[model samples]
Target: MPVNPPPAPTLSGDLLTIHRLLQSPAQIQRRLRTIQDMRFIADQVLTQRYRSAGGAVLYEVSEPIFNTRPIEAVSPGSEYPKDVTAEGAAALAAVSKWGQATRLTDERIKRNARPGNELDRVLRKVVNTVIKHIDTITMSAVASAVTATQAAGDDWVASTATILRDIELAVADIEDLQMGYRPDTIVMSNTKYAYLASDEKIANLRQRETRDNPVYGGEVEVIGGLVVVKAPLSVLPSDDVWILDSMQLGGMADEAEVDPGYTVAEMAVQVQSERLARQDGWEVWGRRITVPVIQEPAAGIKITGTNPA
Candidate 1:
């Protein structure tokens, strides 16, 4: 036996209510969890937890400077030399709950503001809006912390330019630090990605495969052994490219997220609803509390001027 479809909005505001999925906190919580798992540059970084919402977010990095860090030679012996002294260090930054909220008032339904499908669309849109805001903040943090940067000699769009050469330089910069990081991810804006995907030289290098082939399929999934990710212009400038060891880019820290309840404790958008008794409506609220972090600046390289201004 099927349950009857939930009632739609009515002129009698007292009997009208938001669709069940939008009004129930638990249902919205599950929806948020599934959607948050999608790949965003923010999801590529590290993950951490703080005891509280406000205070300094603490992180540790090896004292060896990110660039030009040297590895000491070890001599073959019965016992290895004692560990180097004072190699550990910690840094701190202020972190607080970062979030945004919007209300769904009842007057709109009475005014026939949205069709039933349109009302559901808004429920979905609010979820993305909250998560997208967080993604931008995290990407910005990583961009600012990047100290390893170089300029592409020519815009990747130029037929004579070589993207492989730039990738090699990016990989070399991080490896030279002698930290065991192997850059595995490359990110750029769609416009820059189009240039890379269209380059004949790159296609020639990977034409052996049919799937995701630049020529055979006009799709580019990876280039030069780096997983390619295209980002919005707001997160990545069209002229910039980022190559990084995702495991070392640092991660988010927001203990408040788990405090309310979450077993795995990852940064997930929190959604809740409240009824305005007199107003005859429900206001859906979406928020997340976290901050992105950077532990090894050398683990990532920002290649600038990848395209013409």
Candidate 2:
């Protein structure tokens, strides 16, 4: 019969070591799988929140270069004729003669003067709408890039590099147009500035052939917490990612702000990818890889020497 096995040795260290030694690699991998599942859930939550916040906004900035001439101020009128006595009768007669002469020629002078032309204020609003359209196109382009890159995995960085160049060129073309616009300003109220000029002569001039007419825009409406407007470029991308990209681009004033530096989402994606790549193809046992078993401490070995010092 085989000799009886020696009694188990006592563990001198903390109880934590026993807990760690007994853990299995499969158990650790299960935990890792749970974490990955949770990360995906978190990503979905973020995406939903981003969508509900708002939609794209059209932005435009313009400097109106308009021509204007000084307006002739009208003099205050008297309610009644001035009191006259016999001593000043001659002077009053002379003034009345002069006034009659001026009034007689007023009609002829007005007929000779070129039509009193007023500034074109409505034209400026139309021009602004056009400019905003161009900017909106740029915003849509950027948004397209964003959508293409969202959830792009390892290929996103490479794809966005190309998108960045294209976006720069497109935006540059928009700014290159010399939109020489001049709008007429009108006095809507006394001494207060108003952008829309509704002067009668100005309105008639706008109605003249080859002139743009006033556009009565309707009130802005919001549906489902998003401002909805008819845009030529909004239909290019149906995905939320692209829409988000466009919105971010609209917020930025220039290309310099488009750099994808250290966003939390980006960092999280990178960390997750790195971890997955590193863990791939490795057999996980409990939480550790399988290797040579560590021998336990030897016990119950009796001394066989003849004498002990």
Candidate 3:
């Protein structure tokens, strides 16, 4: 059976104000996830190429095939073998918009109003929600590429004796794929990060001098050649650790004109505002667009069952 559609928003009052905040020139300040570790492909690249090719729906990539034909001793009448290249295509799918809305009641707004910027507080909340949604989507895409061997039973924290061993194993898995990928980054939940930082073996390997500020006081940034990143439990489970050749993980955005791609769009927030005449309040809504894809799944591994000390 088909699912029922959500009821439409009641559009009785005139739109008091509409801020295409995304298209605006003013800088809106808010905390956002650090997504520099991932790669991003622009929609314009795909769209332009598709249009150039008579508006094809799919963008195709062709790779040369080599070393398949064995060289044989030439006979006077023998014919040389022929080799061909392989090709694959990725179709562009519409990334649905994710949005959220909050109603600002008159009483609530008046209670929290400031001298000049009465609406700043409520607007910031809406913007932050949009940013969080983008982060969730990007992280989920990265997590999806995790390999099966790294799951639950092979817990690195549970077996303290094998913590370093597990790290090696995880890196080996990426290298073994022969995809020319090297694991340079490791991300784990805050809990697991604490466990690793306190582990006796891990502490000994830390360099005496520090180049970057520690997440937890005295926590080393690098472990086994991988830069360690502590992620919130909301982004990754406390029991899981992810090792990645970040160059292979990427993000996508829809916009006009073509330029270099970004791992995550520097800006992904847009806002629309409405005045609620009936409730003597206001409504704020926001939306963002992003598509995260792993160009090479072999470059990432996820290990679970880690103890969150």
Clashes of each: 2, 8, 2
CA lDDT scores, all candidates in order: 0.66, 0.22, 0.53
Candidate 1 lDDT, 30-85, residue by residue in tens: 55555443444676554333443356577776445333435567767755445445
Please provide, for model 2 over 176-200, each residue's C-alpha lDDT reduced to its tens digit, 9 standing for 90 to 100.
4423311111001111111113223
Question: Which candidate's TM-score is highest?
Answer: 1
Evaluated against the true structure, the overall lDDT of model 1 is 0.66
After superposition, candidate 2 runs with Cα above 4 Å error: 1-118, 121-126, 129-133, 148-220, 232-250, 254-309
Error of 2 at 249 (Å): 5.1
TM-score of each: 0.77, 0.18, 0.62
Cand. 2 TM to true fold? 0.18
State which candidate, 2 or 3, has the greater lDDT: 3
Where does model 1 exceed 4 Å of error?
Answer: 1-19, 33-39, 46-55, 63-80, 106-120, 208-211, 214-218, 256-267
Quote model 1's TM-score: 0.77
Any idea what lDDT model 2 has? 0.22
**Model 2, poorest ten-residue lDDT window?**
92-101
